[model samples]
Target: MSLTISELQALFFGLFGGLALFLYGMRKMTEALKATAGSRLKNLLAALTRNRFTGLAAGTVITALIQSSSITSVLVVGFITAGLLSFSQAIGVIIGANVGTTVTAQIIAFNIAEYALLLIALGFLLEVAGRREWLRHYGMVLMGLGFIFFGMELMSEATRPLRDYPPFIDLLRQTRHPLIGILAGALFTTLVQSSSATTGIVIVLSGQGFISLDAGIALIFGANVGTCVTAMLSAIGRPREALKAAVAHVLFNLGGVLLWVWFIPNFAQFISSLSPAHPRVDGCSAAGRRNASADRQRAYFFNIGNALLFIGFTPQLARLVDWLVPARAELDQPVQPKYLDPYFLSDPTVALDQVRLELLHLGQRTLAMVEEGLNAVTRGGRQRLNELRKQDEAIDTLHGEIVTYLGRLSLQNLVEPQPRQIYEYLAVGSYLENIGDVVETNWVTDGFKRLESGVNISTSTLRLLERLHEQVCRSGKITLEALEHNDLEQAREVLRSKATYNELAEQARTHLARRLVVVAPSRLDAFRIEMDLIDHFKRIHTLFRRIARLIEVSVSDSRKTSKSG
Candidate 1:
């Protein structure tokens, strides 16, 4: 018997519509989970990954909570690019992400379609009526869960009529060939961009006795391979470290699938033994609760086995990935924002973190310029001053880029503290830019004027100036370090050293003031240049102090928020 036109319409609409609901629900659930977790997830990954085992555990917990291995992989890539996580450490996380994704299969395996509507109704009520934001987030989670099960129910019903259709049954029988099943599963998952969807569909088919246990096992294995595409796509145009991480994901998944492809029957039988037996119904032994259980057990065993096999060889895997994805030389080019990935803009927490990293990069560049400014002024000629000016230009360019990036970020739906944080980052960027301007416009011009006037500073006065310059540079370095690490203590140190810097500036001024009475050619000019340099150093130190205060406020706010939560 063949499916009639009316029956075919029902099948097509039911399957496609159900899939749409499933995918939408997964997306909503992931989004809600991410919102609830927020920056804490980033902090967790940073804090927990002391070694490969801890990193694996972090990866598993994070992926299980978010319900998306792709998000976990992207986070790993971001951390690697930010230099927060090493490539070797990220390899373990990547492996554990695969293991974590099996949780979705386990979830869908529970026979709860009958209650999906109830869940949807309750979740809707809570989402609309809840008084707290977290409550709303949980409501969304419940709604998403309901949609997933309801979708599975629709898919199951859609396929029920196919049981009597000989041609469709013949097509499904071809999946009993492991290679074909793997190809089919991989291709479908790659197109849909959700291995969970493919897994859900395979479970639905098994529940209706449309595919054998071996076929379902092979398809699940293919899902492990197909899901790597998300990581690969995210790595496009990203740093070499990100590319290496994505490559590691592909190697681990594909290698595991190849290792286990030939043993599908044994894998299925083994998982079947682990799963509870379900009685045959309508002459289909695989048509009851055991169908989903067996499929989920297979996924669990496969991913866990792969993780165990690969965890010991992370160093080797990292080396192999490094070899495959070699670093690009242009990645070291100056004046470009390294951490401001547009992909992160969708998640404001991540986007803000990227901004913070970029600010650190900006601070480092500005600090180098400050260190070189004094050298260009006192010892070097016009060419050296011009080189220092070019450094200022780079600083200006980067500051502008940061401002523009922040502008874009402001357009996002920012939550509490993010708006304030953006303003603080903007202030810091402006202060750093002002420091560059002082060096370029005032200090460098004074150097040029002093060079043209044939005025030379006495060795003692130069030494005093150099000491003040050294103190300013020290403060700048400390401030940048504080910003990089978010260390409140370092920010406080910069704030506390303000009086010392002021005293040094006063001593430099008095020393330059004394030189005004000396009788020498261009003596007055020398006094003026030295005095101006002292004032510029003081101004730069003041700017550094301003940045330190901003860091202090930002860090304090973060601690308060963490505590409140």
Candidate 2:
């Protein structure tokens, strides 16, 4: 009995929809896994740039854990965009990610569908009985995995009709034409959005002896190029560094495909021995490919060979990619995400790096502004207080940015000392944000307000306020340096200055108290403004104290470090 064309189309559509469900389920599972492992991943990844081997391991482990290289690459792109991981470091991570991506293919090659239900039971047990969030995440991952295997089984079963279709065999036979097979493989992977998944399907088909070695290699090569579509798509409008990293990933995979395409027969022959097969005897020619045997070793050999071919060459190719894209034009605005950066929390290690950089920017900018403000207030230099105020606002904006970046980073990076550092930076960023407010509040903002009120201060009061602002500004500079260099001695100097600030403030208060005792009502505005000036003097003390505490924490962490060492 022949299936009608329309009926066949309906069946194909249903299969397509099932494939979609399977892909969607995998996506959901990957996301939940990442979310569950978010804190650990963030902390681990946050400190990633310590070395290349570490970075590669990080990429591999994340991809292995997440079971998705596409996700891994997306996370890498995010880090690069945020200035967390540099291009050189990211290249290593991608290498690890390539290794990790092999996990999916390996899983599918296991033919685990018969026991997929077993994991589902374990998944249910963990979901109900487990207390740890990670166990729950693991449960979800297992359940999703069970479903993945189950879905693949159903998909393979559904496609078995092709075995009976002569026309289908004829079409598959045309896969001998490398160009046709390449396009088919690429289109198939692009349609699926998962090179690993699509390639897994091809591997399974090859195992079943439904396709030839030539066709299998073609599909694998096509899948390599096709995988880049995801990286390229995710990286659009990202920073040049991110774009370059994504492009680097694309180039490496594509380069492997190009290199292997020339030597496909040799590769197949070299590998085909591991899964030794009887030559094809059936009219459809199934005998040589499957041999009705499972050869895990062959599968492993394929992965190792492909990985080395790409990773081995990636270092040199990366430089070529960098040259190709180059840097964007100067004066080009940085990429500012409308929402919180997806990549920021996607990899906490990278996000933490970004926050640190932003903080460094804040430290430098605020330090400069505070110094300028000090000169203006103390030395009667042209009142650049307004300029300083604007710089402070820029600092505030950066703080807000860093805070936003950290907030996302914290969600994923909730591990110990690093999380605490993230917290410290968050607070420091907030404080820096407030420094802008402080600059404007006491001096530039309200200073103009006091001047507008037509209140004239005596020379002594003006000189006193000037000295107070100077001391506070100097303390601000020292605290920034102390925090940056982790210098306990420099930090202690802040405490040393505090007593002096308090003494001068007390003297001003005492002198003002005496004047108030003799002053008449006509000097009321003068008295109020003088008090306002005195209030700022006391606030200088408050600001320095806050900065001192932050520095002390850094110093305390250092002592812990020294003792541990």
Clashes per model (N, Cα, C within 3 A)? 0, 4
Candidate 2 shows a clash count of 4
Q: Model 1, stretches more than 4 Å misplaced?
A: 278-290, 330-334, 343-351, 408-416, 517-524
Question: Pairs clashing in candidate 2?
Answer: 39-412, 42-348, 45-349, 46-349
lDDT of each: 0.86, 0.66
Worst 10 residues of 2 by lDDT: 291-300
Best by lDDT: 1
TM-score of 2: 0.78
lDDT (0-100) at residue 154 of candidate 2?
Answer: 61
- What residue runs in model 2 are displaced by over 4 Å at the alpha carbon? 4-14, 32-58, 74-86, 276-303, 306-315, 332-345, 352-356, 359-364, 377-385, 392-430, 449-504, 507-534, 537-565
TM-score of each: 0.92, 0.78
lDDT of 1: 0.86
**Candidate 2: tens digits of C-alpha lDDT, residues 306-333:** 5566555555767887898887666755
